[model samples]
Target: MGWWKKKKSRAVVKEQTWDRDQWRGEKILEALIQCCDGKPNSIKFFTADQILKATQKHFCKFVFPNYIFMGNGTLDNHRMILLRKMKGRSPHPPRDICTGPPKDVAISSMVSDHKNFMKLVGCCFEFEYPVIVYYGGERQYSPVDLNKIVSWRRRMKIAEEVATALAYLHVAFPRPFVYRNMGLKNILLDKNGVAKLNDLSYCVSIPKGETHVKLTWAGKDYDYMDNDYIFNRVVSEKTDVFGFGVFMQKLLTGEENFEELCGWKNWREKNKFPKWLSSYMGEGRMGEIVDPKMVLEEEERCLMEAFLVLSERCIGLRGEVPKMVEVAKELRRSLKQGE
Candidate 1:
């Protein structure tokens, strides 16, 4: 066999023989090294204390259940993350498996088609504690990347990147995933202000035996706020679309109107939803609805308006939103026209 084929064969063998016990720790180290792409390891193994001390000044003390912290440090001025080993909370019983002629073959086949997902940058099963290392800086609300904000070309690139990432999550192999907490803080922006969706602690896959997932929604915001914090509902992909709509609305108006929009008394009495947008559409008050910091020229205005229309459609879904891919396609088409 050729050298390339030999190399491929070796790789497969190596993968097959990979020790699950050493998976998370080694792979996390490798992923961190790759992110640096050149930084020599000053410290071989990271301890949780070292990470906490390094980030004591800023590491927000909010830990989600199930996931644990691995480590965090700075490399080339960018913040890095080494997170806990990931595993599903629920356990699948042995009876869930179907038997075949050969036991090894059946085990391999069963593992190959296992539905529970644990996504990390590199290796899996590195110790019972999963370690996932990624590099990013602190979150800031300012749209620093003017390229992703002011320039149409840059904004389009950002949009495409976000769309692609969301598409990957929503349409991964075997089954699709829906992120429960799809929000601004959940969206991490690189230095370029390009959004990368993060914090998938709320992700859920469509179960193997289920056809449709039930959805529930808590009245818009809790405690009289316009924030898109919903609860008291079983959720699905459409729920994500609904959340996206609220995000888009915020992008457009730079105002918080969720309380009025989602309030039963206010919403039913006066159709208060899309508070700012409704006025703009009815009275050609685009300037009133548009974000003040985001001054748009005529062309930009058109593009923004198109996106607003798309957002309106998304929000209208209530509990019946379109697929994210469909919404993305429609947004893309609208953007092309605006351009």
Candidate 2:
């Protein structure tokens, strides 16, 4: 009888919580309707909670043609909406004159350079900061938060493709771009297994010959950067290289936090590569370090070894670090060799 009472009480509490969430969802739905001028055409309205479950954000997806508008409300005082509109749009989504350059500019500049990027769909400036719409992708196909981790080969492929895309940004662009906010969370692997790098808010374009650019505020992705950017506040292509190295480490070691990365940094500073890595390279101990989820088959070992070496150089000091173009070349070589 006591258990029955407890279960009943718990049921009541859950019902109440759902009711509250439903009410909140209704409010956002109302805002969406208002934003659409009472006729939100060909648009899909996702509840904030549903969007949270999907994107881990408070934003509800106002998905429309060539854009996904993720934001809290439909008012001028609402939270900023991240818009990823399509090509040749104005620089940055509309914003007040005082908020500095609109962040969409980074994304615009990115997709403008290459399709490997997620396109900026554009933003509406009725609000103070502008409600943005980004180009659409398979939201369900986002590989960041999957339940079953795939093979390392698959993941390494994703990393390789992203490295090539980054190279295009840093090298192919008339003015080199420094992608600041780089992390696994922002790299989306679609259903087709192609990699798409998103979140260009911190990306900056600097002059061709400049070694480093001064930063006003560093991003959490700074964990991916070298000590120079994290400690000295100097950003450069090397900073991006360091970040990419950290990303590779994430795949190799499963060390989620940057603080646990002393091995890579120590190797960079002292040239003391990990014994386990050496063993894997020479003694075929790939299983010891490779993700348990991955088999790291004999045929694939050479590719992994080359990738590991490339990742290490990506973390090296400025003089030792290869250009993004060079990094892309090495990754392509690894892929071709493995093939």
Candidate 3:
């Protein structure tokens, strides 16, 4: 009886291993089907062993918080960013259980030509979901590390680059994709201090002939989402503009939670600027609103004021918001004037 029980236990272990292998194979096939635009060769597939070896088996080097790790690849000898998707979590519908990583891979591959966008190096499908790989940078830019980005001029440059990338997403493809998530967390800085926009999990496309698509909010926080999107579920380029406005405010004030600004809680009812911003602007105290950590020269004050004005326009009412292309042009002009 003891010998028979041991044989049954070994059979169960072998069966579990086979089930895992089968699941991995199915997920890899699904990712390939979804992301294989005419140029399937654009996405390279790495084995699970390769990813583990690159990440030092235990993922010792932390890049971004929780999910992302930095590693030196054994096969290619290149530095890489490994993005691991956590298991047993379903943020979308049942049909979309394992779609986020593949969707991000597809969008990253599509925008690979752009300089300000994160470059997708490859992916591994040895787990329940795919593990994405991208070209790594020195570090990620976050609100906590505001001291690292101390110059208003540098902030404007980063803003301009991000705006340009958003504009490209709007017009460079057959169908326009709305980047529903835009914040400091999604912005990465390379070794050369150039900002790269990443994390396209929430990116959605507008159907042909449609100006906007209705989508349930997939982000973890509502602070940066536009009123139109939060209330109506409507997603368009304007949605991105509104989020960009919030991002710019964070960049300017160095505040992680911009909603804490005075009268912000009531601004939705009043449909106007927050009391703190309004009072500061009325008093001509731009210095008070700008990030204290930033060292702004006399000439750069005017540039900051212009940037704030543009940001306000972005978060303004439906008819008042400027398109991303116009925003990009305005930011470029401001950068040139500051120079």
* Top candidate, metric lDDT: 3
lDDT of 2 at 58: 40
Candidate 2 deviant stretches above 4 angstroms: 1-101, 109-113, 127-130, 137-149, 255-285, 317-319
Candidate 2's residue-wise lDDT over 200-293, tens digit each? 5456666557776776556444447677776677778887877887677667656532223346455556766432243344475655566555
Over 94-134, each residue of candidate 1 has an lDDT whose tens digit, in order, gives 12111111111111121222222112222223122333333
Look at candidate 3 and tell me the lDDT of residue 147: 67
Clashing pairs in 1: 23-126, 24-126, 84-130, 85-129, 85-130, 215-234, 216-233, 216-234
Clashes of each: 8, 12, 0
lDDT against the true structure, each candidate:
0.45, 0.54, 0.68
TM accuracy, model 2: 0.62
TM-scores for all candidates? 0.53, 0.62, 0.81
Q: Compared with the true structure, what per-residue lDDT tens digits does model 3 show for residues 1-339?
A: 111123445456445446654654455456555544345647777765676566665655555553554544333466546454533434333242224655667778888769988777776654445566766544443322466788888889889998998998888877787887787767777666777788776677787899988765445456577767878887889989888887787788876435565456566666764643544665568877777778878888888778888888888832589999999999999999988
Supply candidate 1's per-residue lDDT for 334: 65
